[model samples]
Target: MNYNLKYYKFGLAIMAVILTFLSCKDKVKNKVSNEEAAISTFTNPLKVEFGDPFVLDNGDGTFYMYGTGQVENGFATYSSNDLVNWKFEGRIYEGNIEASWTQKNFWAPEVYKFGAKYFLFFSADDKDNPNDELENFKIGVAVSDSPKGPFKDLTDQPLFDPGYPIIDANVFKDDDGKFYLYYSRVCYKHPVESEISQWAKEEGLYDEIEESWVYGVELAADFKSVIGEPQLLLRPPLEMNDRNAEWESRSVTSGEVNRRWTEGSFTFKHNGTYYMMYSANHYAGPNYAVGYATSNSPLGKYQKADNNPVLQKNIDKGGDVTGTGHNMVLSLNGGKKMYTMYHGRTKAMGENRVVFIDKMNIEEDGTLIVDGPTTESIPKPLEN
Candidate 1:
C-alpha cells in the first residue's frame, strides 16, 4: 500500500470518530434538558379553600405544605414535594386552655423547624377578652419530634406574655442561623366613637386603644422564648384613614383612606433588604386587603411601599376578588420559585374563607408584586 494513501485514510477515520462523539454529546444534552422541563412543570394539586400557606422543604425532593389547616381549634398539616399537589398529614396539635384569653378564632398558623424539633406558631382569641391578652394574642409555639408532628406545647402555657394585641406569627432564621419571630399587633388607638370602642365594652377588638405594629423578637438559641423585648419594628402610617369611596357606604368603608392598619406581619429578605407584608381592613369585611413595607434590616424601621398595597380588589364594585389578605411567603426548589399564600372570602354572606396560592416576584426596590390566585391550575416548581 502507498504510504500517502494510508495516511489520508487514517486522517478520515479520526474525523469520523470526532464527529460521532460530538453528535452523542448533543443528544445527551437534549435529553437532560427535556428531563428538567418535565420535572419543573407540575400541576397544582392543592385544593385549599383559603390561603395562609405553611410550606416546608423536607430535603428528599419532598416539600410539605399546610394550607389554612385549622383542625378542631388548632392548625392542621398537609405535605407536598412539588409546589403543587399536597397530601393531608393530619392535625399536628390539639388546642386547649381556659384562660378566657385564647378561646377561639384560630387565625394564622406559621411553623418553623429548629434543630431536632418542629415549632408551630399561631394566633387566637377568646372572643370574651381579645385585647385583654394583648401579648398572648401575639404568637404561640408547640414543639414536636417530627416534621409532620403531634407538636406538644413547649411552655405548657402561652409562649408570649399578653401586653400588646398581636397576631399573624411568622418565624424566620437568618442566614447566620439566628432565630426570630415576626408578628403584627394593633398599636394605634381606636376611634372613641367607633364601633370598636362600643365592641370593646362588650368584648372583641379594643380592650385598650392601640394601633397595629409589626415587631420582631429575638428567639433564644433553642428557638423557643424571646431573649429580649420584641423590638418596635414597623408602625402603621399615622395618617391612615378610611379611604373608602362615598358611593360605597361610609357605612361601608372602601377606597384608600379608611383607617388602614397593618395586621399580617410576614417578613422575607431579598437583595439585602427585609420586606414585611401585612393585611389591612376588616378581616371579615369585603375591604380586606394586603400592603407591604421595606427596610434595610430584619428588625427594621420599615418604610411603607411607595405604592402602598401590593394586592387588593373592589368586589363591592362588581369585581371577582373579595377579602384577600393575611398572607405568608414561601420559597420552592431552593429559591428558584416564590409563592404567596393567603385567604379570601368568595361570597358576600359567607365567612367560609379559602386559601389560595399565587406566583409572586420581587421588584428591584425590594417590594413584592403578586399575580394573585386563580382557579386555573398552575405549573409546579421542581416538576416544571
Candidate 2:
C-alpha cells in the first residue's frame, strides 16, 4: 500500500461578542453562567475527508477553508459563517506545467494574502524528465483576486522544484513579511547501502520516509522566486540517529501507511511561543498520532512536547479512530475560545481521514490541550 497526502490548495482570528437578549425587567432569567455555559454548550463541528486543513478568516464574518483535493487541479475551498457549518466551493486553480520534471500529484497547497493579491504555494512533480531527478519534485505559485478564487498560474514554468519527490508544501510569512516554505521528502534519491535497500524491500518499508527537519528558503520581494539556497531547519533525532528501535519491526500495516516520522508541518503562535504539530507512526495503523514541538522563533531548534502523543486513535477500541493527525488550531471570535481542527478515521467510515473540530483548552502552564473526537454536546453560550 502506498502512503500519500493528497493535495488540496489554498486555504482564523477570534472576535468578542456583546450579546443582548430581550427580557422583561421584572422577569427572572434562567441564564447559564460563562463557565457553566462552556461546560454545557460544546459540540463537535467539522467533518470531512481532507488533509492539511487550512482555515482562512476572510476578514468578514465568514471563514474559508482549503485542502488537498482528488484531481490534478489544485486545492478546493469551503466557506462558513459559523465555525461548525461549511459550504463547498470548487477548485480554485490547477498547476501550469513549467518544467519537464513536474507531473501530477499536487499536494498541500497553502495560500497567503499579500497586499491586494492572493498567492498560492503548491507542490507537484514533473512527468517528462527522465534523467533530471531535480525536475521531478517542485513547488509553484498561482495568483488570485480573492480567497475564494479563480486562481491563475502565475509562472510559465515551475517557480522552483529541487528535482526530488517533495510533498506537503506549506507557506509561512513572518511578522516582518519574510516568506518561507516547509515540506518533507526522502533523504536520498538513490540508496547505496544494502541495509537501506533491504529496509525498502520490507513489506511496509518506506520508499522515502518522511522526517521532522524543516527546510526554508527566502522568497523574492515579489513572492515569485527563491532568493537563495533552501536552509535546513529541523530533523527528528530518533530517525537521524537510527534509534527508532522501539517502533521498528512492528507488523501493523492494515491500511496504507508505511514508515513515518515527520510530515505535514503547521505553525501557530500562542502566548508568545511558536508551536508546531507533526505526525508520527504510519498513517495506516492505530499508532498513527500527532506529536508537537515548540520554539521562540519560527526557524530554529524546537523542543518536543511532553512524552505523550497529542492525538491518537481510541486505543480502547482497536483502530476504531486511527489516523488522527495533520491538524491546525484556530481561534474563535478574537480569542474568546480556541478550537483544534483535524482528521480522524472511524470503523463506520473505513479508511478515510475526515475533518473534526474540538474546543481546545489551555493548561495553567500555557500548553495546548487537544483531546479526542468527542460527541458530547453542550448548550450554546450566550455571549456578553
Candidate whose lDDT is highest: 1
The count of residue-pair clashes in candidate 1 stands at: 43
Per-residue lDDT for 1-384 in model 1, tens only? Answer: 599999999999999999999999999999999887666654322455545666766667766665455576776777765556667777876665543234565667766765677777877653445445533454567778887887776765456764655777887777887777887765334332344334343544333333465678887776457887788776543322423222112212333233435577788888778788887666666667777778877787777676656666545456556777788787775677788877776654266676667788886656578876454445654544
State the lDDT of candidate 2 residue by residue for 1-384, as single tens digits: 122222222110111111222343223343445556664465543565576677777777777777776445467888887656678877787553442233566766777777788887777765556685652656777789998788777765667765455666676677777776666664334332334234545745555443334565667767667877776664544332244323321222332343334666777667877777766556445566766777777665677666436676674754356667667777767877777777777776677667777666667686767766664564432222
Ten contiguous residues minimizing lDDT sum, candidate 1: 244-253
Runs in model 1 deviating more than 4 A are 1-46, 67-70, 97-103, 125-138, 186-210, 240-252, 255-260, 314-319, 347-350
Badly placed stretches (over 4 Å) of model 2 are: 1-47, 70-72, 96-102, 132-135, 186-213, 239-258, 315-319, 362-366, 378-384
lDDT of each: 0.64, 0.62
Give the best candidate by TM-score. 2
TM-score of 1: 0.72
